[model samples]
Target: MFKQIVFLKRNRIRKKSKLVKQVLLLSFDFTSLFYTLLVIGYFVIAIVMEGNIRNNIQDKIISIEAYTVEQFWVILTAIPIIYIIRSFNQPGVIFSTAEYTLTFLPNTLQQVWRVVAIERWIKSGITYLIGGIIIYILSPTSASIVLLYIFILIGLNVLMTLPEWKLFQQHLWLKIVVLISLILINLVNLYLKSSFLSILFIAILFLINVLLLPRTFQQIDWKKVTAASDFKIWNMVMISYVTKIKYRKERQYSIWQRLSFWKKPFLYKKSVGYNRLWHLYFEKNIGVCLKLIGALFLLLFLILFIKEELFFLAIAFTIHSSSTVAASLFNDRLRTDLVQMLPWDLTLFKQTILKWIYSTSALLLLPIIMFIFRDLSVWTLIHVLAMIFSFLFLMPIKIEKVFKKFDNKASDFKWTEIFCYILILLIIISNIYLEFLIGVCLMMGIIPILKKAEK
Candidate 1:
């Protein structure tokens, strides 16, 4: 049955890829995106602790040697606790409509359980594998430590998620007990401060859960499975999609309407062209800006206090985020009749200025962290300037004329911006003498071009 599903998936993917190629061949560059992700993966795996970098949690200036023995386990210990908390919010034994139908086939209940368990283990294993690789990168010791962590994580993923099963989920006490047991075990391990004892406790906990799964699986609630997966609603949506019956474009504002800031401040008493543009920017993007700021705060804490190695993740994040927000600044505003009724040249100029403001503002944290942690050198200075120029370049020079035509998808600068991103990221990572000179000249040239653009 699994083999049949796999074959179907492969055939479906082939057709989808053909359709995507026919549609997006001119608008996208798969190669540039692949290389960009490769660069990020390289940084994530290659990070190492060089010396006594300042850690915000341990000390203002703690040695990596000390942290290796003491605080390294702290990060590892929190992984299971995070999983426990997150599992509570996850859906009950989730199965798609397709998978739900498979249960009615001529298969025993044990066989069904076997297939679901195997598929889920594969999916969850991929997730845990990535997590383990990240922890390995962050570990100051040998790879054996991370390997044990990964093994424990695989078992714990099943154990922790068991609470979401019908037997445990309906009876709140069982769920609470499981949550407390896992949390207490980890907390005790922290107090004992012995790696051997921690591993022993985790192994015992994993065994208990493994023994309990058979009994729990016997009480499987098939109804809850489909309900959790929104089986009926999904079928309706598919039917609507196929029959060309479009859903309503409007979204309810009940939740957001209550937030004081969701209601815009008094920007202008009267609605002018600039006011309209400002309104449009906030109307569409303010929620994203606010959410991003909140996420960045958490990321800032992790990078500063938890692991300075995660600074590499921050750079990759900022590069992609700054480019995305900058490029999208004018997409919705200029693509429609939004700017048509307003003054064309002046509105274009205003939107460009707003792009510069928002993009530069989003990236202020990266440079700050860079200068604080890194040495105050000329290359560091050049790197920061290069990033800013590349961000500015992401907005095509010919954007003034785009989106004015009937064919909205005629704009094909997506790959050009992607190539610019790849070039800038490569230059930033390989900040050598030759690259530094090239970056300087590139920025110098871009400065005039941007000035001409503004004028």
Candidate 2:
């Protein structure tokens, strides 16, 4: 049985390794792959032994920092703290549903635990082993730091079975007390600035969890255990043979949502057609509108306050909003059958949206941006703004025109292939120049592709 378990585990590891190998070989050219590997290897080596990690790296990798030993302790401490919290919610071991089933039927928790421990070690053993060796080298006098790393890894694994004991689950006060006690240990260590004391407390915490695992195995919540491994669907299908599992409760709508004007129609005339239709969908799911608005507001905030991130945010929002608008229009087009039949020219819609975006919103937005940032260029913002609106205006028309070609021929997903060309063209054009010249260049690039695809 143990050999069988090991064989199954080995196969999973092999499949993952094979997929990664294929992706690396196929996706990138040799020169690009070679350079990327060199850069990654340099950083990995730098991180592993930079001045023996007593001090943080001082480098040009802006915003990201490599923490010193003292700071890393806090970050490392978060692991045990996080697992303790997780143990409350999930006491399920990291076995798959099939593995869980097999282990439950034939093996004692201790016996199965040893197998799992071996698997866990196989997965992360070398990584922590290297870490332990480094800690030992750094503070050879403090031998307990090596044990600290070991116990931390073990405790993380053990705490997943936390709720198998009432000391954590049924007793809410006890759990809180345990959490507070652990936190206080950190506090005392911080107050004293004692590395030895912190290491001692952390190791002791993990040791306790390691001891608790087998004792509490009989009290394991099978429902939560199965749920953790996502076995509920299987349980539902085989309801007679397997026990009924309680899944997560359905989402409850807030009182404000129930009472609010979600279902109320937009105050627009019937002639609005697609405009009214889109608004109706947005109204029903107003979160979409609110979220888009929130993102726009966040962009404004980032520009004003976090100026360093403004360019990155602009690029992100441009790409994100472009995809979102394209997706929304595509989904909404499918929803409105009448709108699809109507002669809906994107040129008019583009002009209308651009009018509001370029004139009204820009007038209000650019002034505030200009006031706060005198040195910063508004060119990037204007460029991204134009690109986002271009995608919104172009891609649907591109898709529509592609589909029209298939009206005569046998309908196939050749339009999807055609749209890829249009998308790539727009992206390329937008990156170089930000103007209406995009339309002319776009038509020049697209007409030939359309003709070839139509053939």
Candidate 3:
């Protein structure tokens, strides 16, 4: 019976592999190929440059190494958490036709659950292993520490699939316990100053996780687990480059529906009108902005108190953020069906959006500026305002035009977009008044362009 189950599971994996290959071929395009090569080139360059990049001011004032280890880890941890939250909110799970065929097999439920748990562990191991490799390359941590971390993560991943265990999710106390345990382990390892003891502790934890799994597996809620997991698999398959294919857009939640009355203030406002609608849209999705702003604040705090060498990078990030918020003002509003129904005068609409973008940018910028730049001159202030206003007016139009060109294609990072972002950063830093004038003139061109596009 076990042999049959193993054979069926292997067969399922092979089938999935074949399906993934077909999907990849179907989604392949010259543009996607171009972007893929560009990303590969970028990583190659980054790897080559990594050693030369300096954190200290004497090494090179404006190098990428200006970002500290703590900053990098914060950014890294935030991304997975955000992605997980997004996945949960917009589940795209679909029931597979192949699952019906599995019913003929004996003890199908038990076999299926175990197979799934193993598959999840393998997937998590791959992810953690890649992260470990990146850390090994980038950090000064000893190989032992890196290996221990990776091994512990993999063991924890397996433990998470224990039939009744909920992982570090859905249970606040479990999450706290896990977090505290990790902290204590690290603290003990730091104090002990013995690598052997550290390994021993890690092994003990791994054993505990392994021993608990059988009991947890017996208590597992298969139906609930499968229902949640199926959506995750479907979503991953649809978005993955190895299995990219168009899927129906996930249902979107209204801002009100997503946030309770107490929590809604971060993403809600009392306002009405076409002119005010853009701001309302921004408010509705302000959580993303808040997160970005919080990160920028952290960057600024680090630059001021810890490492002033990252000043250029901080400015670059600020400008990049401004451009992103500006771009969002159009992307969401343009896609919204109700935008057409609004009593929009194109001239007024352009002015309103431009102002809205500038306000959002300033909201993000002022604190950073006040905190970081102590010797702020009027000229510097004017230059910053002029540069941001230019970006506020120009970036959305450029993004809208470019996005329209690739509207049919999957939205993935492209080098062309990166170049545009680099251009925005350069424009901000150049401090050339005539360049700002040119940008203003470019804004005039987009007005008529947007007018025609809207019509």
Candidate 4:
């Protein structure tokens, strides 16, 4: 039974690896593929011409100082911290079909649980070990630093798995506190003197966490955890897209309860017509809108207060917002059967979309007011207006077409969607006025398609 389970796991891994490679190869169009090969070829020629890559790399690395050791730890620590925080709500640990297969196998429940915990620890340790090794090479310091890296890695793995124990799963504040404490402990370790006692303390902490593993496993609501982690709809859909394997949930699961924060009363007293429609959707999915708004606001703040020249990058962000907002707006609507049941006017739908897109694009204008308040240039004004027009006039058509694709139950993403933005980027970098003309013409061409799709 163990051998069979191992074989199944290996097979699944191989299939997933093959599927990812195929999707990547197919995702590249001629233009992207050519550039990709060109870049690879250029790098290959450069490396061949350089004679000895290892020696060159060694020469480059010789100038580094011990201060960089601190920086290395910061970079390595920041990534997993962010990842754990982001996924705090969801414990995405997956075990194989051991629950079902257990009945037929000789392995007891405790044995299976131990196997799961050991497997998880090994996986986590491998990831941390790789990162620690790279950092050790990059910023060699006291031998104690190596020990510190090892302890930090194991400590994080323990902290991350604490959710499985159900101690902090539902307690948001408690989770935050524990995470902060773990971080503080790691930081303090960096300053500690190199000693056998310090190393032993780290080892003891790790062992205690290890000792807690069996209880963690026993305490877990295995059925619930497995159900939630095993067959997420989005994960299945993504894998199916790449692999052409229609993976479905083994057991039925209901949607999670809607968040209560957005359940406030409608914006207006008498919610009628479009007001009602917008309120219903927006209130239910306000988180998406808020996230996008916050990101754009941050960009605006940075460009205005911190660095003015970052406005160039801000323009790209503003352009990207069209796609982001469009996705958020259409995600639920396309799946909603009631939308098709209504006597919806095609023209009204288009106008409503245009209104929303324009309103969203207006947020991008806030940064330009800073320029106007200080010392404004005609070119800045022109560039801003052209981008606004592109978002208002051109982006809606692209968004509407995206809606049509969704309505038709086609693929969720397309290569052309990416290439279109690439084209616009090149044109904008060359000349804004020319981009405006091109945007106008593209809008004209897409209008008929939008109308047809809407109907």
Candidate 5:
């Protein structure tokens, strides 16, 4: 029976292995390993040239206190990243035959113990090897000292996982309580002076984690566990990609159609001249602006609430703004085609784009202003007025000339777009540093130029 179970599990693994390979092909660049090697090579070259400069800085700033703090920070930061990577890989075990073998085996407890032992061994071995390499590189210490530290770090990481693992499978409230307690302890540790007592407290926490591991392992429903693990892997690989594709398609259509709806209230009949032109523009690209507005608001809410981290907020904003801007440019490519067909000159195109920009910006900014301040401030009122003037007068003329002169295609990373993005970054940073008025003025100035360029 045991042998048959093992054989079936092996067959399952062979089937899933092919699926995993397909997932890898779809999800990641095949040349990622080559790219990683190239990046490592560059890092090594940079380190070789700059190592002396770093050494000099270290020499100047060297202190036992600083060194200790730095070491602690490195260890603390590493623990989470390592833990996540380890967890990501371990989901593979759920898809394996061992789970089934354990389920059908007469000595269920014994089979579970065997699986637990093997898992612990693999986890510990991999953690130690990686941790040792990192420590050796960073400190260039003797193997004995590195090995000692590696064991300590690995024990700490594994222990950290136990309470969470147990809680994840059992009572969620208990897990939350434990998590809160751990966070509180970390906070206390941060604010309080280092002492033997504090160290002892931390050691006890580690001990509790280690004690929970066997219990956590014993709680696992082997059959359910195997199925869940397989489902998780497949869900991540197939479901996530499919969901993303569906979301993109929906977003594109929603944005485009929403904008077009306003222009053509009654769609059945053919229109003429300016009406026809307006209809064509509306049908072709109105969705682009609507999409941008939706996206901007989405980002605003996400940054304002979802992520408290400043770095992530900055990254999100950059990506959100740049992609939206690129989409706007791509939409403009169709407008360029319309421009060739229209009796109106390039100036008319510039005016049309400026009007679109002004209307869209007004729609986008109103919600933000309303949300941030219940009553509009005098400065904000003036800023809005300035933006209107700039969009109508300054931006249209300047942007149209630039676009006509350059005639550059939209790309993932165009130099022109990069410059615009840098300007946007500067504006955001300036908003952080300067008065709101200055930031408003800077934004107002850019609007006209952007509008003109669309022409």
Candidate 6:
């Protein structure tokens, strides 16, 4: 059975289609030896640093540090529960018939317990090792205690994963009820300042999940599982999935048109039809716009309610939006082969791109305005205007310059990508300085240069 499992995993990797192979190859190449070196170097540095800290730090300071370490471990444990639940909804990267066969196995409870046990052992062992090292480094006096706590915590985390797994197998309403109950439990624990109890509760839930797993497995069909096709059904159930498919189709169509030399020039002319630029833009990109809007709203909602630390969450959202906008511009640049073929004058093409950038910038600004401002004020207005102007004017020029420089390369990253990096840094710093005017002026300067580049 073990050999069969191993063979299945190996076949999944080996028999991947050309596109999948390409994606895996690209990811591997991009990461390369740096990943191995990075892991080794991090462990070495951590060990050395820990030794130095243990030798030098005072006892009182070490005690304080240990509390921080414990808190960090608790947060890390909680975060991955959400991630594991999220991963189940994602399609499996590795194909496996064994997963199907598991449903048919006799002694389902024993088999399920074995799977859960092995998973917990591996997970808990790693967590214990890391926590042990941390405790030894920071508070060697509590090393053994920390190791025991870590074991408990790891067991708890594994237990928590089980209930969440079972909850995910339910109807949408039932799943929502489970989620709400869990959230209420967490909230009450937080209100009472009960971290250890929270961990314990999570652990209890995992035990329940284990109890339920065999039944869940029994309910699943083994023989017909491999033949199942439900992407369409899933799409119908998940609005987000539907939106994603629409976005993907539109993106693919745009990419195809942009890659076709014969069709490019004529299609470029069609882009400006009826002088109805807004309609054209929406027709081509509303799916992407809606996606961004959804993301922004979701992020703002999380920042307001979900995360305890609002400041970092706010900054993260801003940075995420800015980076996404910059990346989209880069993608647009990659489609420049079609742009070059456009019958429209080069200057006109530049103008149209500038207009598109402005429109997108406006759309992006709506989220920031809604999230960051409590009421309408001159300062808020100024900040909003400055941000919009900067993104509209400066972002396009920077994108154009970067794209021109890296036009020959098909890779995701190039030296020219640094322009967007610098732009993000500037935006962050400008926000810090509260110098809205500086940003506005900087953006204004880019227009003339962009025009000159068009020529």
- Candidate that scores best on lDDT: 4
Better of 4 and 5 by lDDT: 4
Using TM-score as the measure, the top candidate is 4
Candidate scoring better on TM-score of 1 and 6? 6
lDDT of 6 by residue, 1-455 (tens): 45544565466446545435554565466566678989999999998777874466557656665675656434534544463444334211111244455446553534543553464457567867886786576655566666666766665555554454444344444544554455445544444556676567656666677687666545432222222212311223233433344311111233223333525334435446412333344446657765766576557545645542352235445544655565465446445544434443433444555565455444344435544553456654654554444444445554455445444542223332343344445544554465744654564455445454543
| Candidate 4: clashing pairs of residues | none
lDDT order, best first, reads 4, 1, 3, 2, 5, 6
Per-residue lDDT over 359-401 for candidate 1, one digit per residue giving the tens place of the 0 to 100 score: 5365345434544444467666665566556655554433433
TM-score of 6: 0.40
Kindly report the root-mean-square deviation of model 3 from the true structure over all alpha carbons.
13.9
> Which is superior by lDDT, 4 or 6?
4
lDDT of each: 0.54, 0.50, 0.51, 0.56, 0.50, 0.49
Model 4 residue runs over 4 Å out of place are 1-68, 71-80, 83-92, 103-111, 130-147, 164-224, 227-455
Candidate 6, clashing residue pairs? 159-206
Query: How well is each residue in 1-455 modelled by candidate 3, as lDDT tens digits?
Result: 45654575588678767776677667778688999999999998997677554333224422333443323333322222332333332221211333424656665655655554565677778998898777666655556756776775665444333312434123333443454455444434443455565556546646766786556445443444444444444454444644345443334444444345524434432232455576567667678776776687567656754655455456666666656666665666766767746544444554566666556455445444643355477645554554454445345554545354335443323433444454455444444444554554454445444544443
Better by lDDT, candidate 4 or 1: 4
Error of 6 at 452 (Å): 16
lDDT of 1: 0.54
Q: Candidate 1: deviation at residue 389, Å?
A: 55
- For each candidate in turn, give its C-alpha RMSD to the true structure in angstroms: 16.3, 16.1, 13.9, 12.9, 14.3, 13.6
Worst 10 residues of 6 by lDDT: 247-256
Candidate 3 least-lDDT 10 residues: 86-95
lDDT of 2 at 455: 48
Return the TM-score for each candidate structure: 0.37, 0.36, 0.39, 0.45, 0.39, 0.40
| Segments in model 5 whose C-alpha atoms lie over 4 Å from true places | 1-17, 20-98, 107-110, 134-145, 157-162, 193-198, 206-228, 231-455
Task: Supply every candidate's count of residue pairs whose N, Cα or C atoms clash at under 3 angstroms.
Answer: 0, 0, 4, 0, 7, 1
lDDT over C-alpha atoms for residue 284 of model 6: 68
Residues 47-97 of candidate 2 have per-residue lDDT tens digits of: 877654443322321112223345545545555566555545444345455
Candidate 4 C-alpha lDDT tens digits along 1-455: 55655775677778767776777777658788889999999999998787786555545554453444645544344445553564444453454454446646787666665555566677778887786677567553444666676766666665556444454234444655656655554444444433443455446646756776656645455565555455541354555776677765555332122234335554643223554465566656768775777688667767766776566567667677656667557645645656646655544555665566567556556556655555577555555665554454446555556555535753323444444454456435634354455554464355445444544
Model 3 stretches astray by more than 4 angstroms? 1-8, 20-115, 122-150, 158-228, 231-244, 247-307, 310-313, 316-336, 344-455
State how far residue 8 of model 3 sits from its true place (Å).
4.8
